[model samples]
Target chain A: MTSDNTKPWLRAEIAQWLREGIISDEQAQRLLERYPSTPEPVEYGGGKGVFASLGVLVFGMGVMLLFAYNWAEMHRYAKLGSIFFGVALSHGLAALIKDPRVSSSLHLLGTMLFGAGIWLIAQVYHFSAHYPDGFLLWAMAALLMAWVLPSLSQCLLGCALLTLWSAVEVLEFNVLHFWALAVLLLLQLPWAYWQRSPLALTVVLMLLALALLVNSWHLQEGAALLHACLLAAMYLCAEHFSPRMSWSGCGSVFRRVGLPLWLALMLIFSFADAANIVVQLDGQTGAAAPLTWSMLFVLGAAWLWVLLDKSLRPRSPIQIAECALLLLPLLVLAAISGGVHKVGMIMTAANLSVLAYGVLFIVRGTSSLDRRQLVLGCGLIVLLVGLRFTDLFESLLARAGVFLLLGVLLFLAGLRYSRQKQRRLQEQRHV
Target chain B: MSRLRAILLLLAIAAQLGTLAYMVADKEAIIRHGHTVYLRTLPLDPRDPMRGDYVRLAYSLNQLYPSRLPGLQGLVPARRGEVVYALLRPVGDGVYELDGIADRAPESGVFLRGRVQAEAVAGEALRVNYGIEQLFVEQGQGIDIEQRQRGEAGFRRSMEVALAVDEQGRAIVTGYRWAPLAISVSPAPEIDGAAATPRLLVQLKNLADYPLAVVDNAEHCGVVLTVVNRLASSAAAPCGRYLVSREDIIELAPGAVHRFTIDLAHRRWFVDGGDGLQDVREFAPVSSLRLVYRSPAALQEASAEINLWRGELHSAPFSLRGFE
Candidate 1:
């Protein structure tokens, strides 16, 4: 109940005294009562929940196998009866169970059983329609379960199945599944938002990014540029939504995935041959279809909306840098599509952008004294130098010289870090 | 749980069960109200660890030559994965033949909707997959049924799958049976290999109108005999690549019977060892034996005038002691 900073220290001391036999159990208990333990935050029940979900998955597979055994001697009605009975039993058990872990596990099992039933029925009746339709149904059913039961397992399964469905549709049929994307955005996203599960949100965002990338794959030359735009849009969207999010640390998921990918794409573009290849392919393949233009328009609108919203706040240099990074890809894409074959000029600009971004990060990190950002900034420069050395210089002597320079710089950085740590320790001791 | 949640849970469970029920009812309705058509099936029995055994059914209608199809000769050829409809006209004997094909379904006729598995090109057979190309069977029964459907040398049996097609051009396999072919197998007199390793004669009669190219094993157009042990365990004889030249492929006329001699003891026989099935040089006396003939796959050679019989056939079980 005490708000004093030393309460934790005192509580730990009391526990240690109890353990060391200096204080009796009753006295320790009475003292501990004066400072009640802080309640643990809610989490997707850690290892136990994971194992239980896995157990349910395995059990679902077992049930599927048993049905797949295709007991030839059994009548068709018997098989159908068994499938229905199994689904009903699992759902019933899920409903009756009071324990959240057990109930969620049961619900997962029930959802999976229902999916297996769909396939099993197909097996029994020899129904072989579009296989993705089966997955679509399964995903819808799992999503319904997630909505009705309000469980993490159900939501995760729904997301996974929905992704699988979209992937199959795109890969197998070469068709962009707009309906799948619609379901994810309209149905799954709202559920995740309501549930307030960061994990689910992370999955939803990752899947959304993946689905967009896969769906836009047919744009061919436009795909890479579209990807950069999409990723930047995601990052900005995350920033825009962060203020509205009630939960702490939820917005970091988008940045965690998007920023690195954006940087990676920039690094890739910095290579001379990458931009050259894109330009060459664009020339041969010609301009993208009307659909790609419309999609780009939508994505551009979204990016603009988020960027406008972000601009209302006091802008950081890093935000300005990110905005520049997003614009650069669009400029390059437009140049390539406009019949510009100046690969060397574009590559130089890309390389300069990467160097500038790295320097900007280093400056920010130094000013903020943030180690992670500083390391990232240094790592980017190192990677750029290393990659440039690899392709630009064929001779061993030049390569060795580059390596020696890198090694010396790393040694100096390490030495500086050690000195800083020592100084911090001394200051702490003095205080 | 809240009352609203409880009701939702009940609805969810009902929907799950209803989905299963709908699948059953839909298939049943197709069987009841749909037009029944029989098509030939050449199935390969394969085992899946998860799904047990399934027979991969290849039908005669799977491959159609657009050049041969009068209706589709002038039309644009179907690309791979594009949906096409095949108009099935009842030929005779409860079987259907591919009479015509179209990009869209026929207004009023027995037709099947299938995806183009391969591109339709000139002088090449266009492959289509009807999605009814697999039949799940009991564990260990796929091979049995596949073998049984491929009758003995003299009594050739080919399987015909019965399909029920709804009005929407969707079809489901209702049933299948092993039908008869004109081919048969008979043993000839012992060759001059003396007493121990006696030679046996094997013959195949080509019944189809097209010229059949049969792969001659070791220059002998003979079938290998697989022995079934007392435990009902059977292993295939050790197979090796035979250098099949143009001369080695015996092209048979429509009514021609291909006869050749095979020395039974020359090839290694399979026996069940402690570590599963193993092939041995020694042949033990077995209760029953079956003839297995595997033909060469279709030749890519444009000069190939004969249709290569590109599948395996297993003869009905007969005792080697009878020949002895």
Candidate 2:
């Protein structure tokens, strides 16, 4: 039988790699022979995962809606029995079926049915209201199904519910809360990373970490600073993990959660009274954690150190300016502690840092001829300016002026982008 | 590895099914052969006994204070969620009183095993949860049970939990016994040279066929009766607020009455004799009294576990009434 080389793109990729001297000629030939040229088999795409998932979702929804309606007339045992049977039947089907899509979907459906049965039992035996024990049971059952089936979607479902379970746990605030979320994180983190789902990983990590931080640190303002720094460090790690670190690009991932938090803290602290309010709020819970400030400083400094020494070496003036962004918060904090009259100095420094970061991004994008970054960078400056205007001036006239300025700036940026795109298209034609 | 996984999967399924099977078996056994005892439950918003989707069954036996269990002297307080054994004494045909408490299992008689929940009602009462604290009913029946437990006119409805306690003191909440709860307040004549203010005697009778065991009952705090004026105002006088724990258990026998005395003798009323004002009892406003407390009652059920629900053996709520 001839070797199956149905996928010609593999050979094309090998050839390209060979041309680029990434692989030896002999290696390319070996790859080619390993996947030989053969006639393609005729096929129709059947039982696509999406369709199966969609069908199951629709069926599950129908079951939920049907059962949700006036089942009060039915025997409690009957309702419980049906839910139990559905879970057992779906799982039984999952074990029998070999088609991955069908099997995984069945597992997902079974997991959901199991959760429904848990609530059914609760309803049958009147459980407590506003209790989270049911959620814990539901999460465990879903996670168990996910583990047994090794289904990605089931794992995702488990993770999402687990997060909700943790959130519900906040009311009780048991010491066990931290451990449970952490355990779920350890269990699901691998699946998220293996799937290269950055968004999912980001969400899970953020949730688990935030829950742990809040419980351990008791939602103190200082904890927020540490939490932001810790997450930013993780995002930086994810960004630096590899070139193909994510299914989607990992550009400015740390900024997704961290930069906004930093900016928010800056904006909030930019007001003269916010710091004293935060201190008083901290007093209500208990003693403010003694090492909170130290933790914030250590984690923040570590992240800043990593960014400067390891990731970006500040070889150019623009890079050096970006590095200075890390130091600005510390300066702001120092100034605030000194007195309230010096608040404008910190605010001006903050505005300058934001302005510098924005301009640097815009210049970098303009130089590299990248459109998205240009829009984003210009957008940042406009947003910051608008925020500053609102914070500084309460009057409608100042607000109107801010809005007019933002509109003109955006219009100019858009015009410049269109012209740049045209010029780039002409350059490509000339090439 | 796949073989190991298969074994683990089987084990997990087995364990889950085992838990469910065990729960069913436990309840069925208690309902079939366990000894029956009655519990007196108070109306917790009888209009909607079923709060949301859950029927919250609060038994009189749920709370245990250190002072209540006198025999178990120096009984180490059980940590929250720790299981403690409580020995019981039959007060009458169907009701039981807490005799003693122990860390280990009880050998014989009507007793109960319960976990320690944090105290909810006034810091004095230690909350003990028998497995039968909550029962799950069908979706809409929660409201129905709640309403039935608290019939119209407020005090006419109450819930009686019949627990079947096995030899081991393990309990199953087999059923609920329903009855009416009523209160009547009357004046008690003052003795010669008795302090000017007379004592108001509020009598509450067990209208149910079974007896009821109550805890920390002296000064009639177990059955709280509040006095209100014509202004529709409920005032907290020293008489009503006075709570002295003289004894732990008070048994209201079947067809028997339990009397509570509200002291109005020591009231610091004011008197103005057209000159300067002096303290007098004449203006004190307590006229008619409304019984305000949820009477706690006890029965035992048979279940080795804690906080489970089984409603098959339940009876109509036990009734209480007061007469002039």
State the weakest 10-residue window (summed lDDT) of model 2 chain A. A1-10
lDDT of 1 by residue, A1-431 (tens): 01112344455456557667999989988987854644223354478888899899989989889988898889988887877887888888877888989988988888888888887877877665677888889988989988988877888888888988998888887766767778888988878878877678777877877776677675464464545544554554454455445653445555655667677767787777777766664533444434445545665675676666643332545666756766666666556655677777567766766767676665544443446766877798788887788776788998888788767765665566565456445544654
Query: Where does candidate 1 chain A have its weakest 10-residue lDDT segment?
Result: A1-10
The best candidate in terms of TM-score? 1
* Candidate 2 off by > 4 Å: A1-80, A125-131, A173-176, A213-229, A243-379, A393-419, B1-36, B43-52, B63-87, B97-105, B119-124, B153-155, B164-172, B180-324
Q: How do the predictions measure up, each by TM-score?
A: 0.69, 0.66
CAPRI docking class of candidate 2: incorrect
**What C-alpha root-mean-square deviation, in Å, does candidate 2 show against the real structure?**
11.4
How displaced is residue B169 in candidate 2, in Å? 5.7
Q: State, as a TM-score between 0 and 1, how close model 1 is to the true structure.
A: 0.69
Candidate 2's DockQ is 0.14
Number of the top-ranking candidate, with lDDT as the measure: 1
Tell me each candidate's i-RMS in Å: 1.8, 5.2
TM-score of chain A of each: 0.76, 0.68
Tens digits of per-residue lDDT, candidate 2, B240-292, equal: 54333325445667655556665543332122223333222333232333444
